[model samples]
Target chain A: MKIWALQDQVLNPIEQKSIDSFKAAGGNGSLETFGNDPYKQKLRVAIGSPNAPDVFFNWGGGNLKEYVDAGKIADLTPVLDQNPELKNAFIPSVMDGAKIDGKQYGIPMRGMQPVLLFFNKKVFAEAGVQPPKTWDDLLSLVDTFKNKGVQPISLAGSQAWTELMWAEYLLDRIGGPEVFKAIRDNGAAGWKHPAVLESLTKLRELIDRGGFGDNFASVGYDMGGASTIMAQGKAAMHLMGSWEFVNQQDQSPDFVKNGDLGWTAFPAIPGGKGDPSNVVGNASNYYSVTSDSKQLDAAKKFVSTTLHEDSYVQALIDAGDVPAVVGVEDKLAKAPNADYTTWIYNTVKEAKHFQLSWDQDLPADDATFMLTQLQELFLKKVSPEQFVNAVAAR
Target chain B: MQSQRPSSWYAVPAFAFFGLFAALPMVLVVYLSFTSWQGLGTPTFNGVANWSRLISDGEAHASMGRTLLLMVVSWAVQTPIALLIGVWAAGKQRSRAVLSSIFFLPLLLSTAAIALLWQALLDSNFGIFAGGPQFLGDPDIAIYTVVFVISWQYIPFHTLLYQGAARGIPASLYEAAIIDGAGRFGRFFNITLPQLRYTIVTSSILMLVGSLTTFDTVLILTQGGPGTASRIIPLHMYITGFSGFEMGYASAIAVLLVVLGTALSVIVTRATGFRAMSSQQEGS
Candidate 1:
């Protein structure tokens, strides 16, 4: 049995060792691993071919929905039903995306990735500001940081999806979590919604205020370009997902250890329909059994074996991740930074609705199309109406 | 005529290779272009929707303009410089090998390696030389950077091609021109320029095709950011097919690229009056 996984495990070498140990000690039959390096599309092509791996990893929503629709993925509802313990092993909301037509198709195999508004505590202290608690606070901080000769935010503008996070959070804050949900259901009608328009309008304001600074249009996230700015204090804050922490730790260890890399939930919008506690990002990474895989039994056993394994969860925490496993709070307390870990755990736990990132929520083509429109919006080449019209036009 | 005809057996291996590799895949692409599929089972036949979308796709249409712009810039900048180097290096007897190797080193490194090297060197804050243009970030300058890098990598190749033609130019013609009191400028125009006409046209055609389909470097460096400023056709196709999972649409883009490349090549060769220079040679 060959398992295809994201490259993060490769970065944390011991995690692979844990997986290899699981494959050996569990006696889940013979197993092999082939993962990392191949681009997402290349991986999709491989899974679509006859030589598809028995089990593969994915983000579970936009990437997996088409696979499930095409019947190329196995329904994991049966596995979950047969083993209640396995079903209860992960947070229920984290598995919501793994369902297609109300049947589970994927198993939560990695940590949660909720988007966080990370700030530089030293910069904020010097500028006499704190992490924003309300939308107005965040808006005011933009000007305050600029006056203090700091870029308010570091945006990975070269990657459009990083830009899309703003819209996701903005829409969620203004219209609540259902703005994207409605849009995902029906495109044109959803695009015309007042909340959607308001979100785009807000994004433009952020750009106009130099919230991300003038140079943001060229910075990229793939090589930690934006992360560097945030860590080096060139930028006072960065709006990014949980992965930003790990990335910063890798890029600037000094920043991580002493630079006060603080995080808080996205700020609240006044007069908004959205609950302040609503969250958005990648809910979780998952492993799905392919329809054409020859080693179905072994693959299912592999999933079940790794689900509650203390070693697997511990490894994820050690890698600076907040695992989606059900009882991770106590385990997270023992993590490197217990306060940050607890806050993240509580943020996800208390969330009324956790919307996935817009790019990962919409189907693939629409996702790509939407990202382009958002990018154009940031560049100010497209008006708010035009952005909506382009998205609705699709 | 039948008795003089060569046996068809000689073409079997060639034809087999073509059918199994080139012809088969091209046919599949053509078929795939007309249908809606996610690289998985049961492609629902969606007639012309993909093509129709490409026609109205605003970002895509804009990206097409950028791709052609890149092609034009590459042809203008690369060909003349390559010819100059080829002519210069051709005249060098002692250091020809070393000069050629040094010039071709950029082409030898992988695209990923080159992209990384340039990215580090051109980093605005932390690059090797420090503080210059954001080569991979600014949409306005990013495409030009790509053109620069592309020229850097491939100029040696074009130079090598021109060197072959330059070496073939009869020294007798230059000697005759010298006897006629032609200085360096006069001899270059009368002899070197006319002699390299065929090579320039051929290399231009190659360079144009290469520019149209370029992906790896831009993908690594920019991923067509700061809006669609650097988003060329091939990168768009990859994003459409792979990220969007619209394989059929991607194939449509690919098919259009082939048609466009072939059509332009024909038009260019004809416009250049390059209907086989051999015929002109015979006439002279």
Candidate 2:
């Protein structure tokens, strides 16, 4: 049985360690690394190659649908039903995405909150302002930042997904978590919902106010670009993924060293349907065995061992990742944002419902279209009605 | 001892390789263009549907238009500037060596490295050339930067061609012109221009082919962004074929590109008298 682990950057440093561990455990599974940032899209390895990895890493959303439809993955329904103990080990929503037509195809690994507001405490202090908790309050801060000649939010407009963060945040604020789930899940009730359109309209207002950095569209989503604006204290806030915090710690040790980072929940829309707990994210990198693989037994065992409590904790800890396993000892004693992860987990735990990542849950072709449509929305090239209509067309 | 023409049978192996790699694949692409293949499942015959989509699709038209524009921009804009520098560097030994080395520097860098360097250079915030306009972000300015990047890399190749072409012209032509009271401009227009025609046409054709099909540089630089402003056809084909996974649609675009390229090549050949000269046996 040939087993291939299509791993991510978190597993990159300790690849040999995991591989050695797998080998010591008498496994035939081999590991092959893929993307560094799981949130970012990357071209999957070429298909039908002699060296095509049997089991691979895939996003847990509609991306799975594309690959599954392509007939490149193995169905794990039989194994999933047999091992209820294994199924109980990880987050349910994560595994939910891996299931198509009641058949499990992937194992959920690390979970990341892709959209969170990280504000520079020092910048807020200098501006003589409090962290805003309401839509009106944030708008006031926007005015204050404008008066002070600083960008309110350091956004990378060029990054297709980064721009969608605002829309998702606003969706949660206006319609609460239910609306988020409805819209993200492609539920018929949510597509034409006024809350989604209103959310986009509000985001447009922010763009009109120049909340994003000047020429943000040119900036790639990296440590060197708009994220640098926050690290350098040029911007008051950065709404990005949790991975930015991990990367920031790696790149500029001293700049964010103090972990002076403060998180304010995206403000609730005035007279809207949602609560602050309505969140936007999912289990980060989901792993699956290809249906094309000759070795289903080895693939299942490989997943079990790699995600075993002890091995998962060690690997996740070494890589500064949040393990998806239900109960693991929190050994992040020295992690600067250990509290942040805790808060994130707690917030997710308290949420009434989980809204799968909006862009991910949509049809694969629609993912790019939604991102592009939002671009037009931001540029005023398309109105809110037009944006909704365009998505509907897709 | 004549070896019976060295046996045309010896050409079989080379012909076989070409057929296997190129001819067979090209025929397959044509077939694929008329079918719907999602790069995975067995292709379903759709016939003319992909072609019909190509005609109606805004993105497809944009890709073809961009490819043509890039061809014109690189050949018309970059080649002439390169020629000027090449002409200026022709006789001065030290200057030629220095200018030649400087011009060739960009070609040494990998496409990724060149893009990273240019991104830094064109970065709207901290870049050296950032102040006047946000080059990469602005659709208007983005193509120019792409043009500049393509041109900068092509300069050395063009310079070498021009230098060799100028040198290939007979010194006797210049000497005879000088004696006939023809000045430098007269010698150049009457002598240099006519002699370098074949080289210019060949190089321009090469440039046109190259610029039309270029992938790595523009892809890295823009990824066909700022709302597909710099999305050339090849990049469009890539996004459709790879990202969108519409192999048949992408192949249709590819076939159209090949047709466009062949037509342009023919036009260039006739326009530059390349075809006439070759027919007259002036060309080797």
Candidate 3:
């Protein structure tokens, strides 16, 4: 059997060990890995060819749904039904990411990544302000940071997906996840939801107020862009995924070590319809079996047996990942970077709705178009009404 | 003697390779343009839906405009610099040789390396130009920045081309012009410029087509960002096909590119009389 997975230094070694254990357990396979963009393109091409991997790693939601709809993915509902213990081992909300049309096509295989508003604790202290807990406070803090000649927020606007976190959290907070669900399930017409315009108008106001500063459009998430800006105290706050803690730990160890990194849930808007407990990000990555695999039983066995194993889950926590497996609170607390990891674990545990990233939740074509329009929206090239009209018309 | 000439069978391998790699893919792309494919399962024919969509795609139209701007601006910027340096470097001076080698450094680096290098150099906060103008961020300036980086990468190559061509110009021509009391500028115009005409044509065509398909630089540098300001046709096509998984629409865009590229080169060759391939040296 052939398996494909994402390439990451910390994740790959752990996965390699899992693959080794699977091999030792009489499951035969080799793992190939690729960087993010290349992996998506390769998987898309591979799924259409005769050489599709028996087991493959994929983002859940609309990304995987396309494969499922084409009859390319095996329905894992029966496998989960046969082994309820295995099914219940993972967190349900994260697991629901891979559940399509009432059928489980993938199993949760990695950490939960929820978008959080991270701040430079030292910067906040020096500026005599706290991390915002409400929408009004966030706006005031934006001014406070700007007055100190610090960029209020560090946003990696070059990559649209980075900008997407804001939209996801905003829409979820303003009108709940139903607005996006309508867009995802129904089509472009759902983009016309009044809530979308309202959320975007709020986002546009933030942009116009210089929340992200003048040069944000060029700042990237990787290669010392926004992360570095916040780490170095040139920026006061950064809204990013939980993996950002690991990235900061890797890129600027002293900043994380000095206890200067801080995080909180996105602020609540007054009179919002949604619960404050709602969250958004990549829920988790998953492993799915291809329907046409030659060694179907072996592949399914490998996924079901290895992912939720104590050793695998422990290894993930050790690497600073908050695995989506349930009952890992104690393990996360005892692991390295315990403070940050436990916070993430609890935040995810309490979230009323865990939204997969909008890009991952929408079909690829619409997601691609939406990201382009999103960048334009952030650049102030399009107004909220214009953004809504353009997307809805699609 | 006539029997020693190679038979037509010698052309078979070359023809076979071209047919298999180039012609076959072109035919497939054209076919795929007529279907709806999401890069999974079989492509289903959807008639002229994709073509009609392409005709009305405002983004694609903007991308075409950017592509043209990139081509024209890069050509305008690279040609004079490469030509001047190539002619200057053609001299057999020891100092010139060292300087020319330094000028050729960017040519040795991979496209990915060059792009990344410039991306870091122009980064808004941490880069060398931090706090200066937002070279890679500002929408109005991003495309020009792309043009500049591309020229920086390819100018060395075109310089090398012109250097070889310049050296091939007979020394007798310059010597005769000098004997007529021609100045440096006069000698360059009367002897060097006309002699390097064919080289300029070749370099211009390469520059034009190369900029037409320039993808990796913009992809790495700006990613058509600061809000689609730097997105050109090829990048737009890539995002549509690979990122969007709308393979059929991307194929339509790809087919348009093929037609445009072919027409461009043909027009250049025909307009400039480059296909004549006649010798420039007198009494050769």
Candidate 4:
């Protein structure tokens, strides 16, 4: 069997170990990894061709749904039903990411990545301010950072998806996850929801008030532009994924080692409908079997047996990943960067809802259009009303 | 005459290759334009749906406008600088060769490398000009930044063309112009300008069509961002087909590009009388 996964320095070795162990257990397969963008493109082409892999890595939302809808994905409902322990080992919320139409199609394979408000503790200390707990507090802090000659926030606006985190949190806070669920299930008309408009208007006001600063549109996350700015004290805060902690450790070891990295939940909106504990980002990546795999049973066994095993879960924890496996709290606490990892684990465990990123949850065409519109909103090329109207019209 | 011309079989291989690789794919693309395929399974025929969408897509129109602007601005910015440097480099002075070699450095780098290098250098936060104007960020300024980067990358190649043409201008023409009391400016205008006319036409055709198809640089530089400010035709088509998985609509856009490129070359050649070839020396 052939397995495809994303190229990552840390995850690659861990995955290889799992594949090696699977081979030792009388299973056969090799893992091939690719960069993020190229991997997505290659999977789309490969899945429809004769060369499709037996098991492939996927972000488990509308991205996987496309394959499911095409009848190209093997249904894993029976496998989970046959072994309730395998189903119960993973967190229910993260597992639902790959659940479509009440049928299981994928197995959780990696960490939970929830977007958080990460701040430079040293910068916050110099400014004599704490991370905000309310929308109004966030607004005032923006001014405070600007007055101190620091960019209030470091945003990698060159890629629209980075800007998307703000919108995701705001909409979830203001009207709760139901608003986005409507948008996802009902298509473009769902953009007309009042909650979306209100959140975007509020976001626009923040942009106008110089919250992200002027040059954000040029900053990029992948190149370490925004993160470095925040780490070097040029920017006071950065809203990013959990993976950012590892990135900072790699790029600016002194910064992370000094305990200058601080994080918190997104600030609550005044009288918002959603619970403050609700979260958004990638819930977790999954490994889904292709419908046409030659070694279907072995591939299914590989994903189910290897992912939740004691050794595989420990390897993930040691690599700074908070895997979706249930009851790993003590292991996480004993691991490196325990404080941050434990907090994430608890935060996800108690969350009322864990919404997937909208781009990953919506169809490709709508997501692409929404991202462009979102960039225009951030650039002030279009008014909030115009952004809503343009998207709804699509 | 046919017998004297060595068997026609010699041309068979070239025709066969072109037919398979070029002609066949083009026909398939046109067929794809009339069908809906999400880069999966088989395409189902959808008639003129994609064409109708293309006619009304405001984004496509805006992208077309940007592509034309890039072609025009890059041509205007590159032509004069390349011509001047090319003429100067054609001089026999030892310093000219060294300086010319240095100027040709950008041509040595791959498109992706040049784009990534500039992306770092112009990074708004940590770049050389950290606090300066947002060259790659602001929507209004991003497109021009793209044009500037494109010119920086291609001007050296154009300069190489101009340099060769300038050298081929016949030193005898310059000597005669000097004898006729024509100063530097007078000789350049009357002799060099007219002599390099054909080369200018060839370079301009390449420039215009090249800009029309320019993808990787803008893709790597801004990705048509700061809110689709620099999105051009080719990039738009790519995002639609690959990113959005709207292959049918993207094929329609591709067909439009093919038509526009062919028409541009034809118009340029016709307007410049380039088809009427002749020797420009004192005697043919």
Candidate 5:
């Protein structure tokens, strides 16, 4: 079998061990990995090469959408039909991202919701404050945490993705999916839209109120610095996603487990157009077959086997991912942040709309433009009106 | 001339070097500047469209302006510091070689490695000091950080060049200047400065050219961000071609960079009387 599979973040020790076992079993498969790189312009050179692996991991929205539009990948509707028994194996909306114009072109494999709001249980206990259920409560909690000599949240405001997520949370909770769709589809929002302005204004207030850590703008998202404030109990809450589990697993694994790690939906806006349950993302990352694969059959089989097999699901679970595959609740018993995964899985299962994360769903240029605007606005270089107008013009 | 073939055609080798390395790339770039090509497909002629787009493109112009500013500031910051250090080390013969080698250490390291090292050192988290400045993140300070790192790496190169030139100056001239009551500063300004004109001009030209195309260091340090605050021209071109996937537009920017580089070289050469210095070499 001429087989090659491309995946990102699937090269950890656990996955490496599984690949070795697969090889030892006399399966002829090669794995090529793309490590969380966002620049599709560079990726296209690889995708268009003569020897591109049959199956490669990519983002579902713009990246896969572009490849599908270019006719670079196979329509996996037939594959889904063949595996009718496993039709509901993956989360529906996450799988929806891989579909284009009503045909499934890619299958959901790995997923993560890395930016979650994690509160320090110890801080909460000390301050005798409850995890806020509403946006007003959260705002109040920030002041309470500060009064208790602890920060409320750790924010890498300079990291464009982090800042963009701030806007997305506010949009989902206040402006709703219809408003987001309108704005994304047609730039339809006025500069003075309350939801649009409130998101930026609230973030600025958070900064001014010392909710984010000292020099938070300078820290990287995954680095220990941003997470340190939460991990050390110096902060009461951290707005991050599943990636923090990896950072926490090595230091205080128990803190991540046993109800100490709290996961909540981003707080609701008091007077917003959007529903609070309109979560901010679909599948976080996906793998797809590139256009230049020499071993199409092998590649398709590898993807089919890897994603459908129990071993692969188990392997991914051990690697700190919230797997899209269903019926693996038992395998997740040992997960350090099983509660967080359960919360996301349960919430995603019933969500009415899977709002494609704005940063990844938009055209590459437009998304980059958004990221730039977010950084500029967060740094207070531009006003909220200017930011809204900037994105609208672009 | 020898009875056989004359060896005076050394200029042929020089011309060959320029043809292979410099002239051909220039031709390719100029041609590419006129075509709409995405790195993969066949080139389609687009006339002056790319240039026109670059004219109105705020991002392109901003990046170009930043590139020129970086060149000026990096060279200005690096040259005088390097010259002063070179003179100081040369005066202290015992530690001159050690200090010179240490100073030029950045030159010996790869640009990416140096940039990454500095990034880590300047990182707000887990850097040398607690809460180090956002050298690569904050828009307000990113450009200066980039300049500081660029100058840090280049000072040693120019220092060594100046050191060699200063040592080459005849001791007798310094002795005569000292006898004529020219103090240390006076002797340096009058004797050392006049004699090292060729070395200084050559180094200046090299630095100016090097700064114009500096890519790897700035790329690693910031990737030209906090919203194009520290982005130089080459970086802008790379993003346009590799990130934005607009290879034709990137090529246009590249061609313009060549024009800018050439124009700046001409202006600096005129200002520094570099041609006059070269003529003096021939006359001697």
Candidate 6:
């Protein structure tokens, strides 16, 4: 049986331990791991063809919506019903994000990636600024940084999805979760909402304010291009997911150690209905058994191992992620950064709503078009109205 | 026709391979073009829904237009410089070998490696050329930068071809031209240009098709962003098929692309009067 997973040394020991146990249980399977790529275009083709892997790893959200709607993955609700430990092991909030109409299709397998505003404290201090508490303050800081000859925000503008966090947060804060809920739950017409237009308009304000400097459209998130700007003190802040901190730690340890990297909620926008505390990101990665799996029993058995094991939850914490498993708080205290881990856990815990990334939330086609629109809006290529109309048609 | 015709059996293996791999997939793509399938269930016939949508897809059209622009820009920049260098190098003795090696260096590096190197060099914060233009950033300038990089790598190839073609011209031709009171420009326009037509037509065809199908480099570099400024036809097709999961519409685009390529190659070959320039000249 082919067991596919994303490449990460973080998963090496975990897989070895899991496979060893599976073998001990008289289960024989072969695992093929793709590299630690955020996007798995090849896997899409593989899963559609006859040679689909028995089980595959994925971020649980609208990312799985297509597979679920097409009946490509087995509904795991029955499996969870029989295995209460598996159902109860993962944080309930994170689990909801992976389901469709209360039916579980995937098992939470990895960490929570809540989006946050990561800032350089030294840059803020040097510029006599603090992390913004309101949208206006964030707006002024864009000028403040520009005056100080620094980029206001380090944006990986070329990678449209990287620029997506800004829109996600801004929309949430301005129009409230209902604005996007209608769009996602209601389909493309959600793009035509006044709140979406307002969100796009506000995002433009940040761009026009010189928030992301003149050359932002070229920068990419991979290989530390945008992070380098932040680490090298060329930019004051970066709006990114929790993984940004870990990436910063790896790319420039000194920056992580001494640059006083900081985190904050996206500022509250005036007239926005969204609670400032609400956040957006993947709830957790998941493992789903393919519908066509020849080794159905083995695949289901192997994937359930993702949740119930305490050591697996602890392993995620050690990898610099704040896992959303119940009874894992004590384990988090032993994390790489206990305080940061707590902040992440609580941030996710305290939020009234947690939005999945639109690109990951919407069906694939709309998501692709929506990302293009978002990137275009950020770059001011299309007017906010045009963006909304274009998306609404999708 | 049966008189001394090469045995058809000799072509069987190649024909079988092409039939299974290339011809079969192409047939599937064409058939799939009229259907709706997201790579999940069996493709259901939609009766030109995919084709009709593609006809009005402004983004795909713009991407195709941009690809044509890339072809024009690359051909204009790469072909002339390569021809000039190839002509000059054809007369050189020792430097020709060294120059050829130096010019061919970019071709050795994989597209991914080249993109990474350029990403660093053009990086706004840490790149060596960061202070200059945003090489891969600014949408207005990004496509041209891609064109420039592509030319930087491929000009050497064209140059080598041109060099071979140029050298194949007899020394007696140039010596005869000199005796006829022809100067450098006159001799070149009269002799070299006429002799290198076949090489030029072949390379131009290659450059056009390669530009239209450019994917890996752009995928690694800009990902066809800054509002789709750098999106070429192949990139558009890949994004539509894989990321969008609109495999039917994407297949429509693919079929259209194949048709376009074939039409272009045929038209270009005909218009250019494409013919090989051999040691024994056939009068044009």
lDDT sort, best first: 3, 4, 6, 1, 2, 5
DockQ of each: 0.58, 0.40, 0.87, 0.81, 0.43, 0.67
Worst 10 residues of 2 chain B by lDDT: B275-284
Query: Cα deviation in Å at residue B259, candidate 1?
Result: 1.6
Q: Please write out the lDDT profile of model 6 over residues B1-284, one tens digit for every residue.
A: 55797888999999999999999999999999989988777899999888889879999889988998998999899889989988887886777788778887887888888876776677765677767877676778889988987888788888888888898888888898999999999999999998888888888998888787778888876788666889888999988888888899999999988898888888888888874334435342
Q: Tell the DockQ for candidate 4.
A: 0.81
Q: How many steric overlaps does candidate 4 have?
A: 0
Of 3 and 6, the candidate ranking higher by lDDT: 3
- Residues B9-60, candidate 2, lDDT per residue (tens digit)? 9999999999999889889989999999765547899989999988888767
For model 1, what is the C-alpha lDDT against the true structure?
0.82
In candidate 1, list every pair of residues with a backbone clash. none
Query: Hey, what RMSD does candidate 6 come out at?
Result: 2.4
lDDT of 2: 0.72
TM-score for all models, in order of appearance:
0.93, 0.91, 0.98, 0.98, 0.88, 0.95
**What is candidate 6's DockQ?**
0.67
Q: What lDDT score goes with residue A390 in model 3?
A: 92
Q: Determine the TM-score of chain B of model 2.
A: 0.91
- How are the candidates ranked when ordered by DockQ, highest leading? 3, 4, 6, 1, 5, 2
- Pull out the clashing pairs in model 3: none
Looking at model 4, residue B218 earns an lDDT score of: 95
What's the true lDDT of residue B27 in model 1? 88
Off by over 4 Å in 2: A1-10, A13-19, A35-52, A69-72, A176-192, A329-336, B1-4, B92-94, B278-284
Kindly report which residue stretches of model 6 are placed more than 4 angstroms away from their true locations once superposed: A25-29, A36-39, B1-6, B275-284
**Which parts of model 4 are misplaced by more than 4 Å?**
B1-4
**Model 4 lDDT per residue over A1-394, tens place:** 9999999999989999999999998999999999988998899999968899999999999989999999999999999999999999999989988998899999989899999999999999998999999999999999999999999999999889899999999999999999999888888889899999999999999999999988888888875688999999989889999999999999999999999999999999989988889999999999999999989999999998999999999999999999999999999999999999999999988989999998999888889989998999999888889999999998
What lDDT score belongs to each candidate, Candidate 1 first? Answer: 0.82, 0.72, 0.93, 0.93, 0.71, 0.83
By DockQ thresholds, what CAPRI class is model 1?
A: medium
